[model samples]
Target: MDDFREHLMKAISLRKRIRDTRTSTGIGWDIIEQDYVLTWVLFGISRLEKLQETLIFKGGTALKKCYFGNYRFSQDLDFSVRGDYPCGDDLLELMIKACDIATQSAEDVAFTCKRYPEKSPHPEEQEAFDIRARLPWHKDFNTSVKVEVTTHEIILLEPEKRVILHEYGEHLNASIFVYKVEEIIAEKIRAILQFAKKLHERGWGRSRVRDYYDLWRILQEYGQQIDTASLPLLVKKKCESKNVMLHSVEDLFQDRLMEYLNEWDHWLTPIVPDVPERDVVIKELKQQLYKIFESDNEGVRVNRTNVGAA
Candidate 1:
């Protein structure tokens, strides 16, 4: 750890010297700081990949950081293991050990990484657990990246492994298991619908604008090519297993989606420099969601036909 600290200090000093020589590009220091913190997190995530072979990276963070290139500056690292690793306490202990390895690996490059065991609010809901990564340099500003692990659902498609090269840092690469784009889109839609349902019933305090933003980005990239046939049914099953109601697509868009749109703040202003206008996003999203629901229903028909033929 001491050796890691020494390397980190030198790197910081070098970064300061470089910044002093260069003219400002008008990018906010807050964003720069966030990028720096992300590099450390990436280093740790890379180490995590090495530690657990079964861990398949998923969710918004994976979409933004590893693939998609949408750059949303997400704060959580979500993973899905191949099997029910939650079967025993020992697997979690092993995962924590892997996190410690990640901390050491990050420390080697001068970033201090610390892990905290986060208690689940409702473990029975999804058998989910959290491990947060605390970065040293960004301690003053949003220093922690929460890593959530779960083994609740099965992924139908085989995950593809890709080597992610850091956009901000030099000489940084991490190979990770990334879910297919279709899989990601399906899950994102499911999340938005589910969250919208919650907002409709519970009346507003917990609006998740990020999910909406992601869904819009996915639509822009994939358009009508995405397969969401099984997504609604999967989400329905998930909600049922958790004893939550599954709302209709029309209800989600008519009421809750507009509510989520209203909550977009500084935190989720699209970290990418060239972002679509808010009104533009809202318009496109409405059109896209309608199309997506139609496509998803069509997929259900296709699947039913294939099963009947079989």
Candidate 2:
């Protein structure tokens, strides 16, 4: 237990790493909580390496850790499993294996992980679990990291074993399979479209603004590297997997999208150092989307203008 706590204390920035992070980023104690969540996420990732072949690390968390460090502070650890998503006994077995790995790795502490029984209020395709840690602050040892494992979509490209970029003390190290930027970009576009269709049905808060934020970053950083010509096919497969039609560019660009954009400020205010202007992001993002995903048919462009007019 002494060694485990020792490594954790050093990994937590409060004593050392926090000073350097705050001096440059001007972050507050929220970062301390984020770093705390990160330590457990990384430690748990070490246990999850056994499923690397079937489970692919993904979502904004993967983007932040594997590819873009200091990008965003995401809370959940998201993954995509290949087929026949694990459940009941299968999931319990996976968590039990993870426990063994976690326990064996610890020097003296026998801290373990669990797959709890309660259901989270997430989408149907996704299932959530909590990683309970024996932190000194919690009286019941209830501190946790939220994890989502799903079979929501197909893997459009080969997953890569990328090194994790983290500042947790003592190199609390691990590497896992990650999705390609191309797949991520296509999915973000699909998500923006998918969420727009439902944003008004259930509630105003159904939209996820992170997709737009992530796409903006990808456009600025990885635009040249992506195979734009093949993006339409990738996007088609993604939307199809979710039972969503690949509507024409104009059909998907509607007032609902504008409504979705309006929530960007509320979504990103807590996570980023400087939230980009909502209009600027929407304007530039629309231009890039038209350039990349625009249909070759000239009538579609004509329809786009009239669609907005209507």
Candidate 3:
């Protein structure tokens, strides 16, 4: 346990360095977290493929990479199976079978599975599932990683559309089973607008507005990449109609400049004190990394500078 603690501390230090560099360059933490999540999600997908279970990538990761240039941060891993896929008894059994296999192969993994409640009984039923896991220790045995997995029934508004949404308003010209980019973007845009309205109703302050602003910037960046000529008129119609009009990019740039004017004062605010529990978890993970460094394996390094960086 002592060894583990030491390794974990080293890893945390490295992570901190990387985080600091990213922040200095104005990169969001979400992007780093998403990359870590993707590694685990890909592992789970490989397991499903080995079993020959019918699954296809869906949601933000797919949309972000194939369409947008990997700019967005996705918190959940999403997959979809055919509506008619055969299964015995309840949906819960199928979910358990998948989670059980994923957990068995995953290190420091945890999972929860649940069914999406039916909106109406007549036409069809849909189910959803989620899995969470810690990332494998690095080759050098420094740092800790974590991710969440989710699965849901496929539902596309425009059943026949083939385009998938990407970051910056671009779309990926690919098919993932029954899902398409157009539908995904439409749904996401609608959700963003809804959330923005909710924030206003609750009288949320600048931070909440900034969150939506970030999302909008990502969408606009991708959206500009889209080729409207090839899409079905309906898809283009929706894309053209939807707008998040929070503020223009120029306005945001100016706001950021103003924020820097009071950056030190903001950091000193009492509301922003560091939490010890979060630090402890980070420390343990870094110790695990340090152990990897000490071992005379193919890949290990004990660099204090690296530890502090992470």
Give TM-scores for every candidate, taking all chains together and pairing residue i with residue i. Answer: 0.70, 0.79, 0.40
- Best TM-score goes to which candidate? 2
Best by lDDT: 2
- Give the Cα lDDT of each candidate: 0.56, 0.65, 0.39
Q: What is the TM-score (0 to 1) of candidate 2?
A: 0.79
lDDT (10s digit) by residue, model 2, range 1-310: 9987786664453345546665666555455455555544555555564565567878888888888786866767778777554665677577656645654553322345566456555566466666654534335544456677776568989888887776645465677788887888778777766676676576554666888788777776768877777777787788777766556665455676766667777788777777878777766766666677566532223234532222
Superposing all C-alpha atoms, what RMSD in Å does each candidate have to the true structure? 7.1, 4.3, 18.2
Which 10 consecutive residues of model 3 have the lowest summed lDDT? Answer: 267-276
lDDT (Cα, tens digit) per residue for candidate 3, span 1-310: 9988875765565467447635643544544533443443344444443222454455556554434543434445555554344332444565556556545643334433444444564232334434433333434322222222223333444233223332222122333332355555434434444445545567432332222322343334544554322223322333344433322112212333334323332322221123123233233433433432333233222344334221
Off by over 4 Å in 2: 1-14, 39-43, 47-49, 83-86, 96-125, 134-143, 200-205, 250-253, 297-310
The deviation in Å at residue 71 for candidate 3 is 1.4
Q: List the residue pairs that clash in candidate 2.
A: 11-169, 13-18
Q: Report the Cα lDDT for candidate 3.
A: 0.39
lDDT of 3 at 63: 57
| TM-score-based ranking | 2, 1, 3
lDDT of 1 by residue, 118-170 (tens): 46454533333344444444443244445556666567678878665455434
Worst window of 10 by summed lDDT in candidate 1: 301-310
